[model samples]
Target: MTNSWSYSSTDNLWKPPATIIRSLINCVSKNGNLLINVCPDGNGIVPEQAVETMREVGAWMKKNGESIYGAGAADYPTPEWGRYTQKGETLYAHVTDQPIGNISLRGLRGRVREGRLVATNTDVLICEYWNPEVQTLDGPEDIFFNFARPTAWTYPLPDESATVVAFRLNDDEGTRTERQRLDEVRMRI
Candidate 1:
């Protein structure tokens, strides 16, 4: 995805998690390219907003590029957290919004081998859910917990604008879901 693409900050007023990063992430996840425009100022220098946005994107990508570099669509729905990108055995969850509590993956039961917060490389626990969701993040011991146990331990965000959750899928085949671009998503063309 190409960034620092066209944005009308004057009239359009680009919003954050910045449109460029958001577009690049979502497009790459669907196997599409994002062409970022570098709109220059009067002096032919990029504006502070654009520069800062690129820096933020670069910072996030440095750690999480593994998820987006060779990622494709997974057999999953558009998550509230943001988007899903699959690279080989790993599924990258790009969480744009700051989640309040543990966000449950509706059909993600036993699908993940394990998870890590891309920003901090911190481990996030996963579990299979039910009336009393079975959380297996800690270890096998936690799996045997009685009914009414927390599904899984939640991960703490490390002050990132957009954090990616890298999930190593149990199956190498990855998700069966086909690559379908989100209707709301648009490429820079």
Candidate 2:
């Protein structure tokens, strides 16, 4: 509980903006909803700290609300770096941690039409044909996207709260490559 019905000195455990935002994203991704209770003091005044926290959350929502509102649980499982939420053919990747390399979406059966950072609308690399040898052995096609930067250099994420990457999917679902099929046949033979 963030606050009580009435103000108490020790009742509130104030969560940081990042924690609140991350919680909101995780709940939305898992086909769940979060209900926050904001209690006012005896004078019917909201706490300044609570208001500030909400302001930060509201700011993040102003930019990345599309990912949460009207979104359903993604067809795929959650990735190491973050969770995924889908609306129609589009999948939103809520990256909570700094990715070591490219953000990989394993077993993503949807073809990516485009991808971009939700906050800045900056284009991220959507490599469908990346690492053909590795992908062939993996069986299913994986979608990889992120700023193609060297891992040696430390780069800050666009938003520490949660950087959202929007991936517009195609109507045609992903499939195994011909090479993979041939390899399977060979193994069976």
Candidate 3:
């Protein structure tokens, strides 16, 4: 719990701008909530930086709050690009790190209804193509553009907190992709 005034004791613990947002995303991904602490002087007035930070957070919440409020941990393999939050039949993908190319939701081929970015202007390409999960003879797996006729997508990242890719989870897909996040969102590492 911290506020605008970076405590004199520990300055490394907190930072402004998207600190709250980043913390909120991280905590929410792990099924936790962020309790912020804001301190004021003798007067009841909140600090200016605190207020500004809140305004920014509020702006982000206005468009993407649906993915956070009343949401829970997504029952799927964590994506390297970002995190996941599920509410009811909707799976919200909170993309923090930017992706390179095609974003693939492996098991979700035909179970998807409609994808609404609802935040940024980036083009979201949801096509029926399966980018085969490659397995090289070396050691680590190379996950990249699987431009097949199955599952592959691409959504650019946002400037603020995260870029939410909301997918309507159908009843049929419930058993298959349970908590299984979208496969690969980027082509390159």
Candidate 4:
């Protein structure tokens, strides 16, 4: 079953409760998208509160939309605090909560060319590399050995209450054999 609800404020500033935002994050984490609506006044102007809320939501999207839009789920040895999406040689990572820092993905065996913060108009952040000395159970590995500090890229929510961040992975040199193998395993199930 599906459910829906609505909120309205004639005062032109309608802030959905924090509970609502938390719910949204949870939904997105579970592979769901949120469709928020802000009704404009009869004069066709969105309420100030509504605008602020939108800005905040936009910030979250700017930072984390990559994982929500089309990220894939993979099991890793370590707990990754973000979600990820991939298209061909491009992989997107969405970091909803956490201070910006180097991100590491162990047990990865794929060729990665470069890493970038997606919302920042394709700014290159990390140059990808592979370590022949390390290997996953499958075989040779190409893990994100080092992720430098995240670029200054960030989505400033309209409300200015929080921020969201995203990163992209480029593997155009045919280095996703590990991902392909994982796909094969899923198909069998």
Candidate 5:
């Protein structure tokens, strides 16, 4: 469910309605992908507001894309902020809004090896995992509140002013082997 807006007419040029963005987010939340279009003006320049909005979206995606690409519909029992996805033994948390300090996984009982901001090629940080025995997460709320880790890495977008970011989730046993087998088969052909 891609959300695209065209500036073919003046009435719609220069700005995409907020409803479009909201719908695109809804599509993403439902385990779908959004391919938004960024049309250039007659002078071949992107508007400044569009550029700023895209940057904000990219920042949010950089930190929370894991949940969007890796999680399933049932994985996120509660939707406090963003969507989520699960691949194999790992669960991803896609945060739309920047955390004030730290993010909490209230009902997660799985063994988490680590958690880190996506969109950057770096080592994954091994934070405290959820302990069923303890019946509570072992971490300061500030950690989740300040979830967005600043970095110099930037994602290359089709348009420099395009908004939106994405992340993937890596779980135990690595990627699914069946998908690998299919990839090998396609490559052979």
Candidate 6:
């Protein structure tokens, strides 16, 4: 998704692997799809740079594909830090930029049960707050998520391009089955 189809001498304009990873998550969050074109050389061979980048992307997918594989667009607005993707009641926050203070997700409706960093598979602090001053017409109890850094991972996050935090939410009875499945998966991990 970064460069031209055929090879050009100046087409060394390949995007970094991390950028591609972020783009993939963003596309999934927006209910879209990504098609990365691996440009071949004049001799009909893929470039080494492109191959390396794809390998890096594959490595990332191995750890965090759950956030993108079957996710749909989030119902709430995107937060300042990044975009969001959802599967049933579960939400995945794709943090693309480093926040100044805390990562805040606004206008959420479901109750969050648990949150964890997809890369590290470790817990991330998820706090809900009720601010009367900033209350919206949506409801008196406007859901706001204060995603704090967990002790398990570094504060600023090691991944610069994107860091994913998966949140298991409780919204409806149908989601209970999914929640139980997530719980079972967590237990196995």
- Against the true structure, what is each candidate's TM-score? 0.65, 0.79, 0.66, 0.46, 0.42, 0.74
Q: List ranges where model 5 is wrong by over 4 Å.
A: 1-7, 12-25, 35-74, 123-189
Sort the predicted structures by TM-score, highest score first. 2, 6, 3, 1, 4, 5
Report the lDDT tens digits of candidate 3 across residue range 64-147. Answer: 888889988887767777777888888887777766555656445545655667575343455333333452212112222222
Worst 10 residues of 1 by lDDT: 180-189
TM-score of 1: 0.65
Candidate 4 wrongly placed segments (more than 4 Å)? 1-4, 8-31, 39-46, 56-79, 99-101, 121-142, 145-189
Segments of candidate 1 deviating more than 4 angstroms: 1-17, 130-156, 172-189
Best by lDDT: 2
Report how far residue 22 has shifted in candidate 3, in Å: 2.2
For candidate 1, list the clashing residue pairs, or say none. 2-34, 2-36, 4-37, 5-36, 5-37, 75-177, 135-151
lDDT per residue (tens digit) for residues 15-86 in model 1: 454566778888987889776666866667777766777787787678778877778887787887688888
Which ten-residue region of model 2 has the weakest summed lDDT? Answer: 128-137
Clash count list over all predictions: 7, 0, 16, 7, 19, 0
Candidate 5 vs. true structure, TM-score = 0.42
Q: Highest TM-score among the candidates is held by which one?
A: 2
Clashing pairs in 6: none
**Which clashing pairs does model 4 show?**
55-157, 55-158, 56-157, 56-158, 71-84, 71-85, 111-175
Evaluate all candidate structures by whole-model CA lDDT and list the values in order.
0.58, 0.74, 0.60, 0.43, 0.42, 0.69
* Candidate that beats the other on TM-score, 2 or 5, i.e. the better one: 2
Angstrom error of the Cα, residue 29, model 5: value is: 3.0
C-alpha lDDT (0 to 100) for residue 109 of candidate 6: 35
Task: Please estimate how well model 2 matches the true structure, expressed as its whole-model Cα lDDT.
Answer: 0.74
